[model samples]
Target: MPTATIAEDDDGIRLDRWFQRHTKDISFNIVSRWSKSGVVRLDGAKAGPGDRIAAGQTLTWPEELPVPVATRPTEKPREPLSEAQIEYMRAMVLHMDAHAIVINKPPGLATQGGTKQPTSVDAMLDALQFDAPSRPRLVHRLDKDTSGVLLLARNAKAAAFFSKEFAGREARKSYWALTVGVPKIAAGTIDAPIGKQPGTGGEKMQVDTEAGLKAKTRYRVIERAAGRAAWVEFLPLTGRTHQIRVHAAAIGHSLVGDGKYGGKESYLTGGISRKLHLHSRRLVIATPGGGTLDVKAELPPHMAESWQMLGFDLQLGDIEIVEPPPPPLKKRRLSSATSGNRRGERRSRGATDEPKRPPRKK
Candidate 1:
C-alpha cells in the first residue's frame, strides 16, 4: 500500500477532506471512490469517509493515484541579478547586524514563491548570501506591488522575536499614499469593521458590522492638489488583510493606480504610471539592545514623478509635510419632502376637513 503521513498543516480535518484538500484537480467523488475501494487507509486500518483525523496520522493509498506535488524547492538556476536589481538591493539594505538584515523591497517583486514564479525575494536574498546559512528567512511580507521596508531575520530565534513584535503591534509602520480626493477632515480615524466578501474570488473587503473584525486606520491629509488629489498618511492599528487599501477605498477616495479598489477613472493611462502610489515610507521598532530602530524608504520612481507633477521637490528631507486644501463640503441631510412621505401620511390621517361625509357610505 502507498502510505502517507498527515502533516502538521493538515490538522483538524477529516480523512476524506484531507484527500480533497491535497488533490487540487480531483473531485470529492473521486476521493469517496478511492476511500470505498480500500485504496485509502488510515493507520493500517480502513478509514471511514466521515472519520475526523488529527495531525501525524498515517494514511495509505494506492500508488496508482498520483502523488501530490511538493512545494517547488527554492533551489533553482537563476540568471545573475541585473545591474539595476543589484543597485536596488544595495540601497534597500539599510542595516545588517548579526541578528537581522532589513531591506527596502522595490515594487513588483514578490516576497515569497508561488506556483508560477520560481524566484522571489527570499530566493534573491539567499543567492546574495545575506545570511550565514544557505537560506535567509523572511520575518514578514509586503504585498507584491507595495514598495517598502522588509525585515529578514538571520536566525530562527530572531525571526520568532520579530514575528511576535509584529503580532503584538509593537512595531510602528507608516504609509504614504496619493489618494484621488481629499478627506473632508484634516485628521481623523476610520474605525470601520472589515470582512471578506464571499464568492468574490478573495478580492474584495467590505465594511460589515455584524460579522467583521475590528479594524482601525488613523489618517491625516498632508496636502491637497486643486481638488485633483491629496497626499495622505496612514497608520493602521489593525493588520487585517488589505486593511489600508480597503479602508481607503471604503471612505470614497481610492489610492491612485489602485485598480483593484479604484473605479475606471482612477486608472492612469499610458505614459503616466503603472504602479500603485502607496509607499511604506517609514518603520520604527525597538531593537534587542534597547535602542530605537528607525528606517525610511525614499519614494520609488512612479511616486517621485507623481510628486514632481504636483509641484513638489524630492530634495526635501524625510516625511514631507505639505499644506492641505480646504475641507470638502459635507453632505447635507435630506428634508422630509426629499427624504420620504412618512410625515405626509401622518398629517393626512390627522386632517378633519369634511371627512365626516365618508361615514354615510359606511
Candidate 2:
C-alpha cells in the first residue's frame, strides 16, 4: 500500500481530484471500483470520490493495482504559440514588474476565449511571460473591441492580491467614450442597473433599472460637437455587463457605435468609423507592496481618427477621477403593493467576473 498525505493547499478539493493529482496512472474505472470496494481508504476509513477533504488527511491505496507504472504525465499540455504571436504580446506591454504585467491591449482582441473564439489574448498569454517562473495570469479583462489598459499578475501570489483589489472596488478604472448625443447634464452620475436583454438570448445587455443588477457610473462631458456627438469620460463604480453603454443609453446618449443597445442610428455615417468608441483610458490601483500603480493608455487608431474628425482635443485635460461608489445594499423582496411604492429600496451589484457580456453571434 502506498499512503499519501494531503497538504494545506489541497484542503476542500475533491478526493477523486487527489487521485488525479497524485496517481495519474490510475484510470477512472479503477478509482471508481476502489472507492466502491473500500480499497482506497482515508484516515483508515472508507471515503467516496466526491468527499471534500481537509489538510492532514491520509489516503491509502490497495496493493492490487498499487499505483501501476505511474508513467503517464499529470499536467495537461499547453497549446503551442507561434513566434509571431509571442512578439505581438511583447509589443503590447505597457508596464512590467516582478509581480505584474500591464498591457495597452488593442481593440478587437478579446481578453478571453469562448466557444466561438478559438484564439484570444488569454489563449496566447503563455507567450507574454518574459522570464516569469509561471505564465502571467489575467487579473482583469477588457471587452474585445473596447481596447485599453489590462493587468496580468505574474505569479499566483500576485494574482490573489490583484483579484482582491478588484473584488473590493479598491481599484479605479476610467474610460473615454464618444456618445451619439450630449447628456442633458454635463457632469453627473448615472445610477441605472443593468441586465441581459430579455429577448436577445442574453447576447445583448440593456438598462433595466427596475429588476436588473445594480450598476452605476459617473460621467463628465469633455466637449460636444454641435449636437452631433459628445466626448465623455466615465468612471464605472460597479462592473456590470455593458455597464457604461447601458447607462449612457439610459441617459439617452449611447456610445456612437453601440448598435446592439442604441441601434445603428446612433453612429455617424460619413467619415467616422462605426466602431465602439469606448476606451479603457486609465487605471489607478494599489500594488502588492502598499504602493500605487497609475497606468494610462493612449487612444487606439480608430478613436484617434474620430477624435481628429470631430475636433475633439487629443489632450483630455485634467479630468476628475472619483472613488467608486459604496457597494449597494441588499434588497429584501417586498409585497407587490409595497414593491411599486418602495422605489427607494436598494439594489445589489453582483459581478463574479469582469462584467463583459458574451460576444454576440456574428
Candidate 3:
C-alpha cells in the first residue's frame, strides 16, 4: 500500500473531494467502490468517501491498482513577483505573528480584485506568504478609497477563528473622518437602516428604513474647525456596506469628499484635500490561541496633510463612545387566567370598558 499525509490546506475536506483535487482521473464511482472494498484506509482504519479528513492524517490506498493521474490540462503557472513588488507588500506590514498579519492597506488599492481591476491586495498575497504552509486569508476588507488596519490569518485554523469573531461581532473597529459640518449632537448613536438602492445595480447604498438591514454607528466629535468641518470618530455596531457613510449623511454631516452619498456639499473649501476622509483607525479582535490583537494604523499621506492643514492635533485625547442599547419593550402583565397561554388567548370575550347593558329587550 502507498500512504500520504494530508496537508493543512486540505484539512476538513471530504475524502472523495480530496481525491478529486489530487487525482483528477479518479472518478467518484471508482472511489466509492474502493471505499467499500476497504482499499481506502485512514491510519489503517477503513474510511468512506464522505469521511472528513484532517491535517497530519495518513491516507493509504492499494498499490496493485494503477496510479491515479490527471488527464486535464495543467493550470497556468503564477508569475514570479519582482523585487519591487515584494518590497511594496512588506512595507505595509504593521504587525506579524504566528497566526496573524496586520497591514496598513493604502488608499486607491482595492482589497480584492474585480472587473477591470488588474491589481489588488489579494493578488499580492503571494508576496506575503513568508514561510507559511498556506497562503494567508483575508478576514475582513476595506473599501478601495479607505486606508486602515486590515488583518489576515496565516493558516486555516486561524482563519476560521478570526472569521467567527467577525461574524459574531466580537471585533471592535474605530474610524476617523472629516465631516462636512459639526454634528448637532456631540456624542450619540445613529440608528439607521440601510439597503441597496433600487437602481445602479447595487453599486450604491441608501437609508431604507422600511426595507433595510439594521445599522448603527456611534460617533463623537473629536475636534471642530470652527463650523465648517469637524473631526469625528465612528464606531459601527453592525457591519453593513457604506453604513458609516450613509449614517453620517443621514445625520446631515456627511464625510468630507464623499460625493456618492454626500453630494457636492461633501467637498470642503480652504485647501482641504478633496478625497474621502475616512480612515480605519483602530481594530481590536481576539486571536486564535489566546490574548487579543489590537493595532492602530497611521493615516495616509493625503489625509495626514489634510489633518495638518486643519490644525487638528493627532495626539488629542479621545474616549471610546459606545451608545447604550435601546430599552426593552415593556411587557404586559397578563392575568393569571391568561398567563398559561399566549396574550389575547384565553381572554374573556366582549369584555369592554363600557358598562354592560342589562340584557334588555332581546
Q: How many residue pairs clash in each candidate?
A: 0, 0, 0
After superposition, the stretches of candidate 3 with alpha carbons farther than 4 Å from their true spots are 1-3, 11-53, 60-76, 322-362
Residue-by-residue lDDT tens digits, candidate 3, 1-362: 76778888777667887777777566678779999898998988899999888899999887765554432235555678889988999999999999899999998998998786768998888889999976788989998988989999897678878988999999999999989988755665677788999987897998887899988776677788888888888888889998888888887888998999999999988888888999998999999779999999999998999889989878652454433553355753444633533211222332222212224466
Q: Compute the lDDT for candidate 3.
A: 0.80
Residue-level lDDT of model 2, residues 103-131, one tens digit each, is: 99998899999898777888989887777
Q: TM-scores of all models? A: 0.63, 0.72, 0.78
> By TM-score, how accurate is candidate 3?
0.78
Winner by TM-score between candidate 2 and candidate 1: 2
State the weakest 10-residue window (summed lDDT) of model 1: 341-350
Taken over the whole model, the C-alpha lDDT of each candidate is 0.69, 0.77, 0.80
Model 2 residue 242 distance off true place after TM-score fit, in angstroms: 1.1
Q: What is the alpha-carbon lDDT of model 1 when measured against the actual structure?
A: 0.69
**lDDT of the structure predicted as candidate 2:** 0.77
Candidate 3 least-lDDT 10 residues:
342-351
- With a 3 Å backbone cut-off (N, CA, C), the pairs that clash in candidate 1 are none
Question: What does candidate 2 score on TM?
Answer: 0.72
Q: State the displacement of the C-alpha of residue 285, model 1, in Å, after optimal TM-score superposition.
A: 0.9
Strongest candidate by lDDT? 3
